[model samples]
Target: MNAAEPGQPADHVVLRRAGATDARPAADVWLRSFAAALPTVVSPRSADEVRGYFRDVVVPFRETWVADAGYRDGIVGVMVLADDELSQLYLAPGWRGRGLGDRFVGLAKERSPQGLTLWTFQVNKPAHRFYERHGFVAVEYTDGSGNEEREPDVRYVWRP
Candidate 1:
């Protein structure tokens, strides 16, 4: 996949299969994006908890697609696509609202034309809207937190 040179204005980004070397940047983008979005969605956790969450939940997810703008300053964004699920998609805070997420989700749909599904905290209205704008519809709800009792999450699905 070819991404426009960094700092250059361009259209949608290209998606590429992630490799072992992509893990760290993927982790970084995930951490930064989560941190940026956390306070509005959930109670903020300590730094260690965040790091541990990344290690435990994000790192081991094998299927991933990465987006780059042809610069190595850091990973601009990442999308974790496993099975018919889009587990995660995050761009640096600066990169948010630039249509990258739309592009990423579009690419994932192309790769999995049967469609894809993902879970998101019900309180994340912005995310819900974003997904909805991309053709996803809330199909179910369940405990957002893994704990037996907590606020519920809404499951969203997209069908091509």
Candidate 2:
């Protein structure tokens, strides 16, 4: 398959296993991507709080994969997987719609060959469409309670 979809820019990205040193920059990508993609989700925490969450909790506790821009140390995207759940997938503002997400999802499927699950805010229609197009089916919907954003959400599952 082509690395980039039609109309998307061709970017040389390195999808690699993240190390402890990546936690801070990966968190920056997470925070920026969240602000760019889900502003309407209304997170209860500040950007700094989310940054700390990524550094201290998400990066340390979950298995993280980072999409690095070729020739630079910049982290353009991050995917966090905990067990079979895809806990986080975020791309920098400039990296959106550039096939980095496809790469991340491909890596996720490779890592969890059995199947994978994820949650996206119901208000994030773009995310819903993206996940659906990637063969994920919405298996459940929940009220705005289980997540920090307190936004209504949907759970999607992809199975082989």
Candidate 3:
């Protein structure tokens, strides 16, 4: 049911500003996507914990966007930005590799014209490659300490 399936090209998908109603669905996408992709990098929070975190803390606090999946009941993905940093970006399991991420970054660049920075766990090689392909460069690496997950991470920067 992913909107990215063959006939559904991503270019036509609209990225919209997320609202209060989107909090839970967006969080669900985040949790499911994280569960599918990041198990090797960090221990995931329980589903209830993730739902609470995103619904209460993230969606309400961050400037967030969600890609409309046309006919689908929920969003195709979610992006949350904090100032000049790309705090989070998660696509539904079937939505990856559909160019929606590049589109998301283009939007992020528009929102933060100065530059953008993000942190991703070092073990997430696909994420590292994706950001690099989109012009992000690794600027720093940290041992598992500062982040809640306490997983080693790398900081990436993108300059206009």
Candidate 4:
């Protein structure tokens, strides 16, 4: 960040492990992001279901991280890693385009240095572009049968 500019990623965004208390805030980011980024896709889970997943499953069982954007932004983004799979990456709607997503992807690659794989709805062109810009390549495409959303999806792989 430029010295002149304040409150950007380098200044305020801190990526840290998601704690039990972070479950709801992180889930809120995911929910808002999903709605904003994939408006056409249907989410199989309700809001409560998602919060429970974050509390009972993601934070407890997976390598979940939250991008705490200081006091002003609070929990601005969430990323979940299931082994080598970048299972989830979502930034708050207002927080998009500020490099938080890029930071999360960088952190994911650093955590899984050998490689990482992720899935995104085929219609989420922004996600496709973002991941591709981060060195992930499209490896496969599925016809919406295997996922809960029944939405066409693409898989991306990144190898160091």
Candidate 5:
């Protein structure tokens, strides 16, 4: 069950640990969210590049979660809880701003009491604001690679 606060819509958003069966859909959502959010950074990723990313990076991250809108069919969002860090959290563009992210974070925190930490693209102002609203503080920043073509990333930490 979701560990959302009372009256939070996330309380209704079903959250569960992702298994092998969820790989494809979870990857799909991850790709979609990344593509949608990437244009704000350096450049949009090609389909091949996104697929390769899923194959190389995302799939190997075994700890994943999928959030659904109280349905058994479609997925609304996905999150990766890796150790004490929140490695990835992505909601479908259409399903954003409805407290799904908060619910996902809440569930992750409930399961792992060390609280949550994440890295967000520095250019993603909205995400920065959302994380700040959720009590995350920027603790550090790093270049998007050894190269300077891409935007930097800000590391955020949330202490419960």
Candidate 6:
């Protein structure tokens, strides 16, 4: 069962640094969350490619965080911090709307107290609102050219 479900407060979701062993699970969480949250935006990477990325790059280089949903649920959320940029934050579909996102953002702030920056597709209205609620302001907008997905994206920055 999801930690976000009834009687299982999302507070039970434990956030911790991701290890190499977590690469596959974290990549799974990212894939599921991405498919659920951003249906309009197509991902250019295949599942194996994503897993390879997490294994070779994210888990090794990035400050990656994963939310462990108890011993059974494994990783239900994933977040990546690349310097001052919150490069990624994705929760399992069932885990959305929980306070976990807020906690993740809080941790991100603590990790980068001066500021944090992130980018989300223009079609992701929920993400836009979520970031805004956490003091992230839209600083730039780009056409569908720079990114691999070729989808219009907006950059948001949070200043402490």
Number of the predicted model whose lDDT against the real structure is largest:
6
Q: Which 10-residue window in model 4 sums to the lowest lDDT?
A: 1-10
| Model 2: ten consecutive residues of lowest lDDT | 1-10
Model 3, residue pairs in steric clash: none
lDDT of 4 by residue, 80-126 (tens): 99999999999887778888888989899999999999999999999
Could you tell me how far off, in angstroms, the CA of residue 155 lies in candidate 2 after the best superposition?
0.4
Tens-digit lDDT track of model 3 for 1-160: 5335564567767899888888888888888788889876555577788888878888788899998776763588899999999999998887888888999999999999999999999988999999999899999999969998889999999998
RMSD of 6: 1.5
What overall lDDT goes with each candidate model? 0.73, 0.84, 0.87, 0.89, 0.73, 0.92
User: Runs in model 1 with CA error above 4 Å?
Assistant: 1-13, 40-61, 145-151
What is the per-residue lDDT of model 2 for residues 92-153, given as tens digits with 9 covering 90 to 100?
Answer: 87778889899899889999999999999888899999999999999999997888778899
RMSD for all candidates, in order, please: 4.4, 4.0, 1.8, 3.6, 5.2, 1.5
The clash tally of candidate 6 reads: 0
Query: What TM-score would each prediction reach against the true structure?
Result: 0.77, 0.89, 0.91, 0.93, 0.77, 0.95
lDDT of 4 at 102: 86
In model 2, the runs with Cα more than 4 Å from the true position are 1-11, 71-73
Whole-model alpha-carbon lDDT for candidate 5: 0.73
In candidate 5, which residue pairs get closer than 3 Å at backbone N, Cα or C atoms, i.e. clash? none
Candidate 2's TM-score reads 0.89
Better of 1 and 3 by TM-score: 3
Rank ordering of all candidates by lDDT, starting from the highest: 6, 4, 3, 2, 5, 1
